[model samples]
Target: MTLVEGAGPRTGAPPEPLRRNREFLLLWSGASMSFLATRVTAVAYPLIVLWHTGSPLAMSVVSTAALLPLLLVQLPAGALVDRWDRRRLMLGCEAGRVLAVGSVALALAAGRVDVAHLAAVAFLESALAVFYRLAERGAVRNLVHPAHLPAALAQNEARGRAAGLLGQPGGVLLHSAARWLPFGFGVLGYLVSLVTLLFVRKDFQAERTAPARPGRLTGEVAEGMRWLWRQRFLRAALGYVAGTNVLFQMLALALILRIKEAGLPSATLAVVVGIGGVGGLGGALAGGRLQRLMSQRTLLIGGAVAWTLLIGAMALTARPVLLGALYAGTGFVGAVFNVAAAVYQVRITPDAFQGRVAATAGLIGSGTNALGSFAGGLLLTAWGALPTVRAIAAAMAVLALLAAVAPGLRGETAATPRTAEPVDPVEPTEKPVEPTEKPVEPTEKGEGDR
Candidate 1:
């Protein structure tokens, strides 16, 4: 376990769980606000472009600009997160987003908005977000006790999922109300996040061993990649997620095609897709409890199997109601799987590696999303929707079965249980507790012997 220096000793009762923890509540609220803003702007950006240019190409360019940073910035940003003070990094990112979005609103108000300006704003804001997300993921490891990790991460997942579910429509509503309203509201959300950050007194980063050399940033990134490459379970999990992401992309395209084939309204397709968000929210809320009840293996493997079944069911029916139900079911499994995977990763990884690990994982998953979308377009055009859906579902089922039986998941062991830092009740100082139990190392049975 890692600990900050200058912590003398425990004084009184243990620190309360996150629900009652002052710092945690503030952080959670701030993060939620930021998420809502980001989500709103995600929809608003394209709408702004559409309003100005009335060209589908303009909308695509602006939208693609936001996603570019995920592919390009995550690995380098993760290394920077490890080197920088996380609290300051988050503050800077939020402040930058506020400025970026506020600028767009101001431009719109002045009737000076253009495609180039929107693209620049989108790229810059998203680049900052890459750093902010990595920093936040690392900070949570230091913010609360090990027991609270599951719940904290679960809540975090719910925040993102909730934003995804509601942000777009909310943005459209606000845009309809006024062109500048969505970005204006987004500015307020970031302002709230900044204020919350200002109030947080605790340090959000682990003590660094050495100052990061700008010259060695490349070496640092390579080191992070190597560390991730050595972890057997995470390596397998990344591959699984990457494959599923590709399939999910196909499912999304298939849904649109299916709706058109059935002579359903476009609004019906939106409702069906939107229902999946509720499933995600439900799963995230239940994640901590499910973790406490089930072994990591059970939750992950069961989620995989469930995902296969739910997505496969889509092959048998095109009824809108059944399709929505199937989508929701898959979303639930995805949430549970994500929570379980995050908990495992956080617990097993040392504090220093959190940023890079998160970056690597995120990069791979996100990179595949682009590929998946491209592949879905091709497959849908070539094979049509029904055959494409069934083929992908069958392939996913085979992969899930293989992952379930893999050695990394056998025996249902907790992945490298981390020692929770005992809180100093009087001072509110958090330090990592030393591990008393001899948990299995990552390379047990020569599994990670690469």
Candidate 2:
């Protein structure tokens, strides 16, 4: 893989910032709207499961089915992403999801939808989302200068949080109005995304040497896993996220049950949950600046600390407003952590390996989340809501503390530093270079700045 070089002499005037980059604008706007719609489905899916099956267990099962792709499909999908054109892969995934989710909408219109149907559609949509995300991650490096990676990723994070801030409540309210409404809009969003993707001018991925036929897939997957395993800091961060996701998923299930038992309307529960999204939105808007001030390590560990305190507080409160406040605090911290992590990952990973590395991290992180959903369902079934939430909150707090002290994560700088003097741009070539056996290590010189 070629190392990204700094900018060289421009043919005319200097290259414009991504703000005026038409291709990047199209990519960003499309993805922003699509993510918003996806969030709608994310919230609506659970609500539909609960409304139809009226079982927390059923909701969890459907959620697990949706997440199961992260566990099973991520590696293969990542390998394919590295092989395929990222723009095409993203386009295809978006198109596939449109069809899959639209089918659900149609079934609802005909009044023929069921839990089994929901599970199948959810699985298909989520699997597509995983591929779509990996392709997007892989494509970002190609869409802008290396110097702009942090800002681009931070903006992307903000886009997602904005979607969450609006979509979660919007989904619930729409579902309350009509079950099919969210999915119908989801179709429209994808259509917009598809058109925008068609108009993007730049290449979204670099060329790669095709691996020899037979055992390539397994080798590629193993390569990604090995790369991640060797990155001590990233691996530890993965563990931290995975652990927190488990408890958070459990907490979500418990919160739903608590609202139900309290006899609150679905809209009330939606508002409480949606309040967290506001914090997320605020955090995303600030993440670029925050990373400039704090080291990546600081952000990682500090986020852990914030989560521990916030979740612990959650255990002490049954009031919806108080719980909402705690959730918002956690979201704010989580958004910052996400931006830092994404920037670091993008900076450190080579273009050729981007898809695999992203997929590997996501596979492990999301696999844990899926397990959490399943365990949450069973735990809530056996122990009920309040006790289950308390126990899990305590566990998550202890784990966060452990992560803060973990050797891999404790000593790294908060943000990667950007280079000062510009260097020549590396030209794209078809010739294959020798693949390095050594894992890519973080440099003492930071590659991220405000």
Clash pairs, candidate 1, are: none
TM-score of 1: 0.90
Candidate 1: segments with Cα more than 4 A from true spot: 1-13, 408-413, 416-434, 438-450
Clashes of each: 0, 10
User: Model 2 off-target regions past 4 Å?
Assistant: 1-15, 42-64, 106-119, 172-180, 209-215, 254-268, 374-397, 410-450
User: lDDT values of the candidates?
Assistant: 0.77, 0.74
For residues 338-449, write the lDDT of model 2, one tens digit per residue: 8878877776555666778888888777777768889999988998877787787678768767876788776342222223222211322222222233223222232342
Evaluated at residue 268, the lDDT of candidate 1 is 87
